[model samples]
Target: MILPFILVLALFDFDNVLLWTHEISLVSHKIWFCDAIDIFYYLNTRLFLLFFYFYCLLPPSTQPQRKNSNSKMATLAKLLSSICVCVIVMLTTKAVEATPTYTATHCTNTTTYAPNSTFQTNLDILLYYFSNNISQSNGYFLGITGFNSVNAVGGLFLCRGDVATTVCNQCLTTAIKEIRQHCPNQTEALIWYDECLVHYTNRYFAVDKIDPRVNLNDGNIVSSVDLGRFNQSLHGLLNDLATEASGSSESKKFAAGEVVVTESMTVYGLMQCTNDLTNSECGTCLKNAIGTIPNGKQGARALLPSCNVRYQLYPFFTSSSPSSSGGMKLGPGTIAVVVVVPIFFLIILFLGCYYFKRRSKKKILLPSIMENFGDEFPTLESLQFNLATLEAATNQFSLANKIGSGGFGEVYKGVLLDSRQIAVKKLSKTSGQGTIEFKNEIVLIAKLQHRNLVTLYGFCSEEQEKMLVYEYVLNKSLDYFLFDPHKERVLSWRERYNIIGGIARGIHYLHDQSRLKVIHRDLKPSNILLDKNMNPKISDFGMAKMIDIDEHQGNTKRIAGTYGYMSSEYAMHGHYSEKSDVFSFGVIIIEIISAKRNALSLHSLDFDDLLSYAWKNWRDEKSLEILDSNIEKSYSYIEVIRCIQIGLLCVQQNPDDRPTMERIVSYLSNVSVELPLPQEPGGFMGNRTNQIPRDNISDQRNNSNTTGSSVNDITMNNSFPR
Candidate 1:
C-alpha cells in the first residue's frame, strides 16, 4: 500500500524513501524484521496518507486476530476511532514522553535457572520477541518461546489502550530491557505499570491472575460533611463504567467518567482491562480493583495486572479536548479529511492493481473453516440458525426494521412466522483477513437464561457474516436515551433506581445464580437493554472464559488488568478474584442523575467517557467553580491516566488522554506515595484541593513501612530473602 507513496517520495529525494522501498519489496516472500512497523511506529502521522499507507502496507501476519469478534463493522469502528485519535497524538508529540510507569515486579527466585541454561535461553528469546515483534496497533500481546515444553517461556505486554503507539513501543522496550535486570536468572518476572503491564513465566500463565498488586492511597480521606454521599457518587460512577467497559470492544476494555457530588466537588474515576481478556475477565479485574479503593480516601488506586481502578477528588484521568497546558484535539471533520480520504483513495489504488492481476482478497468459506475446529469446539447443532432464515425474519435487515446501530453492528427488529419477536444482530467481516477463529467456547452464553438478561436464542455464522439472535427488548438501549439531550421525557428517579437494581440482578444471576456462572464484562448503559416495564435486561454477553477449564491456543494463554488491597499471599504471588462491584456501580447511577449536566467543551475531544470533563474546573479551583467567582486558576481535566504522570512520563497511557508529557499534570492528584516523584514533575501530576506542590508526597506517613513496601514489591512472588 505504501510502496507507491514511497516511490513518489524517492523522486523528491526524501532521505529514507529509497531505503523503505527495498524493505517493502520483500513482503511477497517470508520475512523477518521489516522496517515498515518501525517507520510507522515513530513516524509523525500529520499527513493522514502516511498513517493509511502504513496500515495498508502492514504485513498480514503482524495484524492482530479478532478475539470474540462479532462482526467486521464493529471492528472497523474501533480501528477508526483509535486511528483518528492516534493521528491527533502523533501530531501533538506529547504522549511520546514519560511512560511505562513502574508499579511492581514479581520474580520467582525459588525457580531460578542458571546462567546460559535452557530456561534462561528461552526467557531471552521471549524477551527478544516482545521487543521487535509485538503489534503496536494493539496494547496487548501474548507469545511463548521455546523449542520444548521442558524449557519454554511465555510473556505478555499490555499498554493502556488510550496511550499512543510510541508510548506503547517505549513501554514494551523498557519492560524487555529491564525485566531481566530486575530479576536476573529468575524463571518468572511480572512487572506492572500505571500506563502498561508486562508479565512472563516459565510456568503457568492463565487467562486470569488477580494477585501481588500494589495498593496505594494519598491517605487523605474526604472530610466532607456527606462522606457517604460522596462515596455513593464515586461508587456509582465506577460500577457503571465497569458494566460499560466490559461491553466495550475486545481491543479496548476501558472506561472513565466523573460523578458530580456538589457544584464545588466531583469524583473522577477509570476502570480498564488488557484487550486480551474476555469481557468477564475485564469486569472481574475492574471489580477487584474497585473493591480495594480504600474507602473515603481523597484519592485511591487499585493497581494490578488483570485490571485497574482509581478515583480522585480532582481529575486523575485525561478528558476530551486539550487543556491550555498541553496536547491538542482535532475536530471529527478534520480527522475525517486527514485520516479517511487517504484511506479511501488507497483502497481504490489497491483495487485497480488487484483486478489487473488476480482477486487480491481471498474469501474463506465459513463451513470450510469450521471443519478445522477440533472436538473442543462446542456443538453449534441445534443452536445454529441458517443465514437465510435470519434474513427472512428481519426482511433482509431493511432500514425500517433496523432499530439501532453501533460499533458492534446493526440491530434489526425481526418477526418469525410463529409471531415470535426477535432482534437480529448482524456483524460483517472480510474473509481471509485477520485471524478468523470463532470462539465457539462461548456457547455457554446461549445457555444463560435469566429474566434480567436478554436471552440468546441462537447464532448464524455464514460467509462474511456473523449474527446473534436475541429476545427483542422494545425500549432500545439505556444510553440511547440517557445520552440524548433532546429526548422528550426524562427517566423518573425511581425508574432509574429500579433500572440499577435490575441490572444488578442480571449481573448477580450471571455471577452467582445462572446455570452458566459468567461475568457480563460490558455492564454500561448501552448494553443494558430496557424491556416493557423499564426493567433492565443485560445483553451482549461479552463475559469471560469458563471457570475450571484449561484452554490452550498455541503455547500461550490470554492475560490481563490489575488493582490493589491484595492478600499477603496473593500479593506475593499474583492471584486475584472478583472485585466488589459496588464502586463501579456507583458512577453509572450518578450519570443517570446528571445526564443533562455533560455539556462541557472537552466532550468534543472525542474520548468515550460519557459523563466526562464536567470537572475540568475542579483541577485547579478545587471544585470552586461556584465559590471562586473569578475562576482564575482552575484548569481543565488533565489528570489523564495510570497515576505515573508524576513519577513516570506521560506516554505509558493512551496518547489521546495525555498531553505531551507536560510538567504539570494539574492539581488533581499526587502519586508520589508509590513512584519516585519526578523533580520536574516530568509528566502529568494533578493534586487535590488543599494539597501543595511539595516533593514530600511520596514520603508516606509511615516512612519505615513505605520503604519496605517498595522493596517488597519487587520480590512479591516469594523471591525475597527469608
Candidate 2:
C-alpha cells in the first residue's frame, strides 16, 4: 500500500512540475494551460497513475503461475495501456482539428451557365481560371496574371512550404467545391484551408475589404492587470505588420514579426496579403484592417484586402524544430499544484457544505430587505392616487389646470398641501408606455440634478394610477417662439443665440460634465423647457442612457425621437452617439436663428434639408437669406452667419467630424476660432420625413406630458420668448 501511494505521489509530482512550468508559460506569455495542450496532457498522466494504482493493488502471492493465467494478466495490461494510448491520440487529433481549414471545388459546366452571363457565372469563371492557373504552374504571378480575365479583379492565395503539392491541389479543389455549394449563386465567396485559399468575386473588391475576419483567442486574458501594456504592444506590432505586408512585392505579399513584451514573454504576428495586389494597394488594405481593432484588449485577428493578420502572446503555429527558447518555461506557482490539488479539493468540498448551510438563512433574510425598500420609497409602494384630492388640487384636472395631453397621458397644474406649485403628469394604464419606462424615468431623473435639467419632485402612485410631479416652468419651451410667425419677432437674434448657447451647454452637461454621460436620444424643441428667467433646462431623462465615458457610440433596435431632429445614422443604422445629439443641436441652432422648423421651412429654392439649404446659402454668400426674416433686421449678419456655419459644422455627415460637447462649447464661445467645412448632413429632412409617421409627433408629446406633469398648459407662444 505504501509503495503504491509513493508511486502515485511520484507520478503526481512529475505532472505537477509540468503543470507548474506550463502555468508559468501561460502567465509570463499571457497564454493558458488549455491553450497549449498542457491540460490534455495532464489529464492523460492522471489516468495513467490511476491505472498504476489498480495494477499495484492486485494480490501477487495468490496469483496463478500457469501460462494461461499469466497470459491473461499480460493481455489485460496491454489492453489497458492501449486504451490510454487511444485517449492520448484522440486528444492530439482534437488539437489538430481546431486549426482552421480552407478549400475550393469545381462546378460542372452546363448550358445554363455562361461566362459573364450572371453574377454566379462570372464568379465560377473566375474561380475555375485561378484554379487552372495554380494547377498548370503558370509563370503568371498572382496579380500579374489577371488584367484581362476575372482574375484581374484580385483574389487571395496562401501557400505553405511544408504542405505537399498534391495536398495544396486537393485543398484548393475542395474549397472550390464547397464555395459553390455554400454561396450558391452569390457573386463573391471565400473559403479557407490549411494550405491554400480559394476566392472569386464579380465586384471590384481589390480595394481594402477588412471586414468578416474571424478573431479566435483564449477567451480569458492571462493577466487582466497588464492588459493596457499588452494591448498597446499588440496594436503597435499589428500596425507594423500591416505596413510590411502591404509594402511587399506582388510575388509574395506577406510579413511576419515578433514583439518582445518582457524577458519571458514574446508576441508573434503574421500578416499576409493576396499576392495580386500592388504594394500601395496592399498597404492601404492592411491599414484599414488594422484600424478596426477594438482598443484596450489582447490578441486580435483581422482580414484585409490583400492580407490577413493575427497576433497572440503565445506561439500558435507548430514547428518541426524545437524552439531555441523552449516552448515556454513554467513558473513556480504552477509546480505547487502537486501538493495543492488534494488540499484544494478538500477545501472546496467543505466550503460547498458551508455555502448550503448559509443559503437557507439568506432565503429568510431577503424578504425583509425587500419590504424595507418598499416602505422607504413611498413613491414605488403605491400606483394610485385619491381621485378627489387630485381633482381638488387641479380643480378636477380642469381646463384651467390642463397643461397638455398626448398619446399616453395628460399634464395638469396642481398645488400640493405644502403650498408648493407643481405640474402633475398622469399616465394612462393602457398608454403605449410600459412599466419599465415609468420606473426608469423615476429612477434616472431622481438622481440627476443639473441647472440645465428639469427637477423631479415627489411622485404619487395608487391602484392603476401613476403620477409624477415636476417643478413648474412658467416661460414655456423654445418652440413657442421658434416656430411662430408673429411670435418669432420676440426672439431677437441675441435671445435666440443665447438660447442656442444655453441648449448646447445643457446637452454638453448631460454628455460630459455630469457624473454620468447621458445621451438624450429624443432631443427636440419640446424637450427644451424654459424657466421664468428664460434659462433653458433640458427635460426628459426617460429616454436617456447613462454610458461609460470611454464609449463613443451604442446601438439600439428601438429608435425613438422626433423625426427632423434625429440623425441619419441613428435612424437608419440604429446607431447613436454624442454626435447624434450634436446633429440635433445643429438643427436647433438653425431653427433658433431662422425661427423655422427644418421640416416646415420652404425658404430655399433648391435644397430640401435645412442643413443643405443653409450650406448652399452660406457658400453663395447669401446665408442671410435663410435667417429668420424677423431676426435678419435686428441680428448682426456676421454673428448670424457664424452661428449658421457652426450649426452646419455640428451636423456633419460623419460622426468623427462632429465636434464633441467640449469642442462645441469652445467654438460657440470663441468667435475668432476657425471651423472646418461641414459635410452633407446625413438623415437630413428628406430621409427623416419619409420614415417617421405623423402620429409619432403626437406620441412624443404624450410621452413628455406623462413624464412632466406639474407644469400647467405649457405652450410656446409669442407671449413667452424664452
Candidate 3:
C-alpha cells in the first residue's frame, strides 16, 4: 500500500493535476484513455493496466538507434520512458494518499437524454452552477433549471460538513465535471465523494430510503482478546454520535468525537446526514448507518444516502472541524450505478461495496447496538410476564389502576398472584423506542440495583403491547408529597433529609458503581418514587443515556427533562454531565429544606425563583431563614443551614464549582466538614427561552405562582419515563 501510494504521488505534478489535456502526449494520451475507463479506472482496472503494460513494453520497431542523424528520435524515446515512470508512480499514489475517497455513484438508467438535446443542455447548465457557485461560504448548494417539464432538471451538492469551504468547492467542481463524464447521457445522476456528493434528477426527493448502504473496514484487524472491549466502546461511541448529530439542523447535520476503546487505542468517529432530512429522519438514517459499521476492525464506516458514519482506530478527522467523514463502498441493485474509469486524473478511490436496503417500510426503527443484544443479554423468559398475568393485575389497564401518565404512556399500580404489588408501565405505540431498543434498555436497567434506585421486576412484550414491570412503591412520587399542601406534612424533616441523602447516593452509584455509566437525563420530582418508609427511589430509565464509562459530558439539540430543574448549561446549551445531575439534586435539596415548591420558593415582592431567593438570604448570613417554617420544631437548625449551604454549592452558576455526588454524600454524613461559600445563582429561566430548543421541551404548565409569566414550570414527564 505504501509503495503504490508513493508511485502515484511521483506520477502527478500537483501544478498540472487539475489541468485537463486535449492534445495527445505520452502522459496526456494515456491519462485520457485511462479516464474514459474511470478517473480512478474503477479502482485498479486489471484489464486496462495489463493491455497498457504489454503495449508499452513492446519496443518501437525499426528505431534509428545508432544513427547520429536520428538523435531527435532517441531524445523523444527517453522522454517517453520518463512519462511512463510518472504514470506508474501516479497510479500508486492515487491509491495511497488521496483525500476524498469515492464511495459510489447512482444513475437512473430508466431514461436517457440524446447528445445536444434540450434536456442535456439543461443538465450541463445545472452542473455548471453546482461547480461554479461557491461564494456563499457554505458547503451545500441546490438548484433547478429548465423551461418545460421535458427539459427540466434539478441538482444538489453536499460537501462533508467538517470540510473547509475551499476544500468543499474543489470537491464539488470535480464531482460536477466527473458525474457527467461517468453517467454520460443519463437524465438523472448522483456521485459520491468523501468530500462531497452531487445529486441531480428531474424530481425532488419525497420519500427517502435508508437503503443501498456502503460498509468498509480499512483491512485492519483487532485481536481476539481485545475484540469485545473494542466492539463495546465502538457501539457506545456510534450511538452517542447519532443522538448528538440527529439533534442538529439541516445545513450541517453532523458530529465528530473520539472514545478510548482500549488502554492504548482511541477510536475516532464521525456521523453526517444530508441537508434535507428532518431531525428524526436524520436520526433514523444514522441509527441504521451506525448499526452497519464493521466489527472487529481497527477502522470501519457505513454510508447511506440519507446519512453516513465512520470510525477509525487512528484519528482520521480534523479535530478542529465541526464534523469529519471517511469510509469505503460499492454496491449493486440500482439500475445505473456507475464505477468511473481510472484515467481521469480526478478519479477517487472506491472504499467499499454497497448492499441494498429498501426504504419501503413506513416506520423507521433504531438500529442494532440497542436493537439486538444477542448473547450478551439475559434471555427474556426469566424476565417476561405474560399479557394475561399483567392484564389481570392491572385490571385491563383500567383508569382506576392508572396512577400517572407521561410522554411515553401511562403507569398503573398492579398486584401479582403472589400479592406482590408492581408498577406496570405501558409504553405508547408511537414512542420512539422500538421493540428491540425497548427490550435492550430493560435489560440494562434490570442489571442496576441500589436501594435508592427503582427496581425493575421484569417486562411484558406481547406483540405491540410492550410494558415494564417495576416494584411498586406505596408512597407514589416525591412531587405528590412535596407539591400538594395536604400531603406535604407526611414528608417531615427527617424523611426529607433522608431522601436527599438517598438520592445523592443513588446517582453516585449510577455514575461510578454500575458497570455501565448511566446519565439520567431527566431527573426531577415526578420521576422519584418513594417506598413504604418514604425512601426515595429514582425511576425512568427510558431516556437515560448509557455512555462510555470514561465519557464525562454530552450535548444534544433535543433537550429532555423539565426546564427549571435543568442546569443552565444544559438548558441554554445542550451540554450535560454528572455535574448537571448534581445541579438538579441541588434544586431538590433546596426545595425540601425550604418546603417551597420549585416554581415559587416564596412569594416575595421581587418574584425571585427558589435559587435566587435562597442565594440572597444565604449571602446575608441568614442561611437558617431559608428552611421551611413547618419544620420549626422537628428540624435541627445547624443541619438545615448546612443542607442549604450544600444546596447552594450544587446549584452554583459554574458546573465545575458544583460538588460531586461523592462529595455531597460526604457532606451529608459528616457535620464538621467545612463547606464553601455560596454564590448567587442564575435568575428565573423565563426570559432565556430563545436559547433553548422548542422541540421536546416539556413541562405540564406554567407555574400558578407566576401567572402570565413566560417561565417553563409545573413540569410533567415529557419523554420515555415511568
Report the number of the highest-lDDT candidate: 3
Cα lDDT of candidate 1 equals 0.51
Best first by lDDT, ranked: 3, 2, 1
Candidate 1, 98-127: lDDT as tens digits: 656776777767878887565665565456
lDDT of 2 by residue, 392-489 (tens): 45555666567765454667876543334567777667754534345556666766677888887756554456677677777677776676454523
The all-Cα superposition gives candidate 3 an RMSD in Å to the true structure of 28.1
Runs in model 2 deviating more than 4 A are 1-392, 434-436, 485-489, 600-607, 684-722
Which candidate wins on TM-score? 3
Error of 2 at 392 (Å): 4.2
Question: In every candidate, how many clashes are there?
Answer: 62, 40, 30
Evaluation by TM-score, superior candidate among 1 and 2: 2
lDDT of 3 by residue, 292-348 (tens): 766788887676656788887765555563222222333442112234334332222
Q: Which stretches of candidate 3 lie over 4 Å from their true place?
A: 1-381, 433-441, 600-607, 683-722
TM-score of each: 0.34, 0.43, 0.45
